[model samples]
Structure formats: C-alpha cells, structure tokens
Target: MTDAPLSGLPLPGLPLPGPLLPGPLVDDAWLAARLDDPRLVVLDATALLPSPGHDGDYSSGSGHAQWAERHIPGSRHADLTGELSDHEAPYHFAVPAPEALAAALQRLGVRDGSEVVAYDSGGGIWAARLWWMLRAISVPAAVLDGGLQAWEAAGRPVLGEQEEPAPAAAGPLTPVPLPHAWAALPDVDAVLRGERPGTLVCALPESGFDGSAPTRYSRRGHIPGSLNLPGRGLLDEAGRFLPRAELAARVGAVLDDAASPVVLYCGGGISAAGAALALTLLGRDDVTLYDGSLEEWSADPARPLVQQG
Candidate 1:
C-alpha cells in the first residue's frame, strides 16, 4: 500500500537500466552476455593492499595486474581509491570530485549512458564502493555480484597481460553529478557529542572485554553509546554476503528496534559500506556513515572509549 522506499527514486537501487538512471548491483551472468560489447563499460574496481608475504597471490594491485594480464578481454581499470576518492577527507576512499569522476570514466572508456559494472577481489569492498558512487550520481552501473573471485570460480577466464584502451561508449555522461558529502566526519568530537535524538545503529562488532594488545585500535575499545553490531555477521565463509532471508532477519531486528538514522562504522570506513549496502537492499534509506570510525576516534587522544578490560 505504502510506496516502496526506492520505488520512484532514479539515482539509486538495483542493476536497473531505466529512463533516468542505472542500477546499483548486477549479477555475473547479466554482465557475461555483453562482456566485449563496445556500448557497455566494464571497470575493474579491485583494491590491492601489499601482500602479507606471498608471491603476489591476490593483492588488489596483483588483481589489476592480473586483469591487465587477462580480463573479460576488454574491461578497463577503475582504481577505487584514485578514481572515486577525493583524498581531501579523512576517510581514505571517500567519493571523488564529480568532474574528476566523469573525466576518469571517460578516459576509462565510460561516456554518459554507458552501462558500467564494477568489481573487486577483496570481498566486494572496493566493488560496492564504486557502485555506490555511480548510483549516487544517476550513473548506470552495477557490481559483479560475487566479484572477481566468483568470476574466476566460474572458470570464466582472466588476463595476466596488458592490453590497449577499450573503445569509448556513445552516451557521454554529463558531469552533473549528485553530492554525497558527510557534512564533516565524526571525530573524537563525535563521541563526546552524545547520541543523536532519533534512532541510529552502530555497526561495530561487539568484541570480548578481554582486551589484549589493542588490535582494533590505538586505544583498544569502542565509541560511547554505540549499539555494537559486528560487520562480520553480514558475510559468510567465502566472504560473500549471506542470503536475503538471513540478512533480512538479522538487519530487520536492528532496524525495527534501533533508531532509523542508521550509522555504520568499522575499524575504518571500509567494512561499514558493505553493511550499509546490505541495509540499502533491505529498503532502509535513512542511513548515514560515521566516516572517521573507530580509527579516527581512538587516535584523537581526547575521546572517551569503552575498553574491554
């Protein structure tokens, strides 16, 4: 009876290719059909951290290098940190400047109206981030449901060699992007500020009070008044998301009980996006992210922390 939360919105939602905008997520098979199509744009959104000590097994760089080495055969690279982030905010991979994003996509063969798909090897963290930004600006885009690992798991194929730039699409996207500013991130100041009057959920996992060395932070604790919600519960063994039935049950409890102004955070800003995206799929739109997260909070030297001692 009531209107669907995302019923008429043109800027965000699924892997929809509609009149006013594109979609937020897509499955692998849908993308496979148009892998090499010129009108379609496929941007690799892998984020690589330095390998722990292996022979370049699967860091983000290695993933890109691997892609160049072989991809869907013609997919272009969309560096998550560089192409999507402005680097001006404390959040490492926050959204990039609209003009910069437009130009970068153009260089990567993306033009207005081009169907875009982003993916990552690191459990969809980077992939979802890129997808979120594109949808924010009414760009037609989606995330490779399972991501690179799934692509590889399907025995699809990969490229370990460099290739030339893919051809550009016809729909040249205007730089008239939407704004996704955080209105200034929450710092140590946020913790001391007390909870907002309405509803909000803390996505941080509840750790045991037996604090050892502070693997979680510079201080080894959590923010004041935060309703601890472990992000790991949102994923399964292989690092992909849990089924919708399970996801709805878990997240719904929070939404039904916790306040509507849902705020997600992790050790840093990365994992929070995944949880938030999942919530978005569940049709809860009144959500915001505490960009600075516990890292910024603990490091500030002036914030109060509920340590597990």
Candidate 2:
C-alpha cells in the first residue's frame, strides 16, 4: 500500500459513513434522549468466553451476568456468539442464514423499521458484529457508541431485573434474500486473489505489521494489499472510542490515500468491525468485511499470504 494524507470527502464532521443504512450508530447522548421511546430497541451484547481472566473473571461470560442483574431499561441481550451464532460451524458466530437471522430479530420485537441498538462492554466490536449482521438481513440497526461504558459514564439507568415477556411469533423481515445469503461468505479463494481494492482493510496493529498472526488466525501472515489502520488504534485507555474529532482525523488520515471499495478484516473480523464502525461514523457508504479474515485465509494451504514491515 502507499502512504497518503487525510481525506476531506463526504465532509469531515459526520457521525458515520454514508453507505451504512440509517441508524449505523447512535451515541449514549443520542440513545439517552430516546431511551424510553417505544420504537427503540436496545440490546445487551457483553460476552465472556468460558475462559477466566488473571483475576479469574470470565470475559464472554459477562453478558448474561450483567444482563440478568441490570441492563438499560427495555434492553434485551444480543448474543453474537451465542443465540445469534452457530456453534456447529466451521467457525463460531458465522452469520446465520437470513431466515434464521430474521427470526432471531423478530423474537426481540424487531419488525420492518424497528430501531435496533446494540452494545457490548467492549468498545462496540461485538456490537458492530451484530449491527453488520442486521445489515446483511436488511434490518435497520445501530451500535451504542462507546457501548455500556459510555452508558455508565452518562449515569444512565440500568436494570437488574425485568419481566420476561413471552417470546413473540414472527418470521424473516425481508422478502428479498441475498443471492447466497444463507451459504454465501467471503472465502480464501477471493481474498488470496485480492479482487477488490480499498475494500480489503486490515485492522492489525502497525507495530506487528510484518504480517505476524495475532493468535486467532491459522497462519502468520495477512492477505496481500491489505490496508493498515488497526482498530485498537481508534480507542482510548478506557476501552471507549476516541473523541469524534480525533477519530475523524485518524480515520481520514488512513483513508486519504486508500483507494475505495473499503473491505475491513482483522484477526477474526472482530476489531475490523471497530474500523467499520469508525468508517460508518465518517459517512462512507461503501464498506464490506472479509468475514473469514486471516483465520480462513491462513488455514488455506493453497492461498498466497503477504507480509509487510
């Protein structure tokens, strides 16, 4: 890739990119104002894997622990790796079939035009996964910027318990389906080919950009011609996104030279969602993620892998 300056297109001050359907993202301030609106649906996305932390704290296990105790009023739990995912897959949290996804959303009371908001304790990475899934299904959705941390910082109310309403009965929201929505996915073949420019973005840390694998990927290198603007580069110490001005400056700096057709992918497509979140904030409408990411790419014995320092 070539070095470039900050981009000035689509204006610099917008909240998110342009291709993102409406409700790409909404901040705590915005959600706080509309928290009680019946049209709005909030989701809790905090998750902890079965693994324990140094302090013995479970990571992906936190969502249920927190949600069962207290959550934003009217918010439901959105499990990216759980209810919304498939464990019987080649990979975990592989996007569910459109029919299955729509059914899942309908259970949460999401209908045509239902305003959906998702947030995780993490800086909206997992949340954006859900947001992206919703987009795939053509559902209007947004992530809670800064996630629950921002909610707490704003002193917003959280609920420990709430009435569990009867699960609703509904079907897929969209009548039109993806040409391969159920089975279609970004594969190693296409990525190794590097068919699209600017769309194939890498959120890997610049410090380790020699194409070192970041644990999740099966191989030690990244796909060829990938963009480098690590998602972690977009965060502050508290695990929240940087201020809009700084975020724009950094994102614009990266995109200034980037060609177009933005496609983002990280170790496992997690952190890249953070960059996608940032791009959406910038108002760029063209963006897609290589879902299989390096994990799928590196695992392929036939695909080519490129490294940069």
Query: Who wins the TM-score comparison?
Result: 2
lDDT (tens digit, per residue) of candidate 1 on 1-309: 111122232456656444321345555655665575545677777766542232112233335664576566567777765756666765456566677777777788777657678777777866766766676666777667678777777778676667656466434667665443232344324434654443334555555222232334556666665665556577777666778789898877766677446666665565666777787777777666665676566667776767666
* Tens digits of lDDT, candidate 2, 7-70: 2235567753332224576667777766655456677776654422232232343367667676
> Per-candidate RMSD vs. true structure?
6.8, 8.8
Residue 9's lDDT within candidate 2 is 32
TM-score for model 1? 0.75
- lDDT per model, in order? 0.61, 0.65
Whole-model lDDT for model 2 versus the true structure? Answer: 0.65
lDDT of model 2 at position 89: 58
